[model samples]
Target: MATSGPVLLVSQAQQRKSRTYTPSPWGDFFLHHVPCTPSQLLSMKERAKVKEQQVRQIIHETIASSDLLHVFEKFRDESGAIVSGDDASCLLMLHDAAHARTHGEEILDGIVAWSKSRLQSLVVQKNLLEPELAEEVRCALETPRFRRVKRVEARRYIPVYEKKSTRDETILEFAKLDYNISQAIYCDELKELTIMVELHFWMLGVIHDPYCSRIMIVKIFVFISLFDDLMDNYSTTEESNVFTAAMERWDEQMAQQLPAGLKALLVRIFNATNKIEEELKLQGNMHAELIKKMVINSAKFYHAEVKWRDEHFVPTSLEEHLQKSIPTSACMQMANLALVSLGNVTTREDVEWVFTFPKIIRGACIVGRIANDIVSHEREQASSDHVASTVQTCMKQYNVTIKEANEKLRAVIEEAWMDIVQDSLEQERPRALLDIAINVARVADFMYKREDAYTLSFVIKDIIASMYIYSV
Candidate 1:
């Protein structure tokens, strides 16, 4: 019998080597299949144009290390809460390759190593039949040289947008306003849910013409929904987690559309989530109202999508998924639902923007949790339940098995936030809208520094930077 370990690594490596020149399986999978309108594509270009300018100005300005320190050191009324939110968002957002460049080069190397390790783990778990493909993924993920060039491009991309339109000025101002609004929003647990509401409408706002491309717009919506579900609970409990709600809302529609094999896969996923929910007895009390509203609206969105597909309606440039979900009767005054419903409206109504604010804040919360989990995933497994015992579980997880991966992630988060801040400042960019994201990265760095789990290397700083993204 052949040894599985070496055989797996060699196969994965070869695949990675072969696939480097072509589009990645994951990339191709996402690009063609994901739904979005033409208007959404135009919106993405607009956002990207604006984002590019913000990034460029940051690169050109003589930003002092002291300015960076000052921003990090500043205190707010809800300093603790702000810090927590900031750390989580940064972790979630900057887990990409491009932003990993601000730190020294080793962090990129570490990502490659981690990808390789993931391939190895997949083999051990029997999740990979084609080890060569796994190796290919590892190779693609390992491209430090590529990442470096991308970073330069990203930096250059921001400045070119400075000349675009007056909309840039207005957006920059709005971002600054979000700083105060975000802090206020986060202070009240009820108000925090507003984050989701705004993001959804942001999706809606991109509907320019029927023929406009809406890939970026739709991507944001889908991402927010998936992320919201992931953050709420990975389990499939009926008590009402994000996953359970979405499943309930979209199950039939998705099921009818899917082929038999895919439908079976969906059923299994649903069953698994439900089982997890049962095992955990996951409390819906914390996010009950928010879950209810999200479920109702999500169901509505799915309902409309199904109708359009069933009728074979002329593909409207903008889908009317938004039209079906609104005017929920769920009372927000009830504390349980109030907190949940705080930031979850589906309209672009004046009050709706506040509702979506919490998604970003909540995203930060979840990202922080994810980072902590990265530190502790292994140890938690040995426990009777795979529950985390410490706040710094991610740090702990990094220390024991994948120290370098954790370091790389942290560095990326830090650099990403700094770059965003620089862009916001230099281009009059919308820094405030991304407050939660920036704060998440900042607090993560602070936490890591205090924990001293790993060496304070340049690579670690880079991961932390990549965590910051501009929502402006």
Candidate 2:
């Protein structure tokens, strides 16, 4: 569990008592989540498998079909086919460009560029569309489907599609059924799905990739979450530094000097990390060195932040802060580790590409780093031992209002999304690998979009219920 997001801080024992963490809003409710009955579980799993086969068939058909990716190559207002023709032609071009762009095909980039430009103008055209249609056009222009997480987009599109004049009853019916079954599978995985669990699901489910890695990822997350709290709210800097050394040494004996809780945590982490390595080896991945290095490095980053807190250091600039914080997100490590569970679909080259922090990995990390900071900064700043967060540092460096600093961070997230899109078009990386990296960012954005839904579990209690408690 490599800690990510803003590091929590606590003062020394001499100055003041160590801080304590806020309890989970759900409290002991987590202890009582009942698994679905066996019959219900079988039904949902069977339905999901059927849908999986249908999706595979569709993908085969798509790859085997004739290429229409270039059908709108010359479509433009001046070409006398898009704008000069009837409104149907304009609509057709818009749909075609949108379709290709969403699929990550760069073959129609020129057409997409022109189509988007014209669509932006047409969004304001009063006579061409009804008021409702105009609003849809604007919304589509502002937040295209490619920019959304698939699960989020599905839940959102239900009402919109229900209102459409030509909506297919069969498609809508299947969508509702599919949503419920997927939610069941998600909920069945754990008591409640936190943001990292959501991230683990999406990283694997986006392309229907192997899920053998999820067990490792989620276990690591729980361990790291506990360790992060202990380091940030309870332990002295001396204890954290020793625990970090113990991590690097990979020895239980090295942690003997620490308190009982920390020693137990270190042992659990060592066991969890080793279990991951062993399980992955059985899957034909022998990257123990890489996996061990990631765990060690994660501890190092956590220790560094603790040092910053103990010294009362405020980063002078936002870049300086990100230089340390982004790595703390562990996006690169998570992406690399996930490749192992993919079995053979991914290559060593893909793992190396991530290790180098290519544009896609860096972009994904930034999205997670900045989005987490945005929601947690205010609560973090309230602490006397506040370690400088992205929001706080931005306000200090740019001398802007809190709202303005937030706006700036949101803009940065948008740019990171662009980088994800741009890298996908390159197609140099494996598509499976690309989805793993891209969806890391998407999960972060979804979790932190409106509030700290991850931390303030109450905010997403309904969503959790929708996935776990109710049937569609």
Candidate of highest TM-score: 2
**Model 2, residue 374: what's the lDDT?**
91
Model 2, range 68-177, lDDT digits (tens) per residue? 66455445455444433335335533654453243344445444555567666776666887665666666566555555566656765676788888876646656666
Task: Name the runs in model 1 displaced over 4 angstroms.
Answer: 1-370, 383-401, 426-431, 443-472
Predictions in order: lDDT: 0.33, 0.66
lDDT of 1 by residue, 101-189 (tens): 33354444343344444434544555443444333344333332222222222323333334445335644443333322322222222
TM-score, candidate 1, is: 0.24
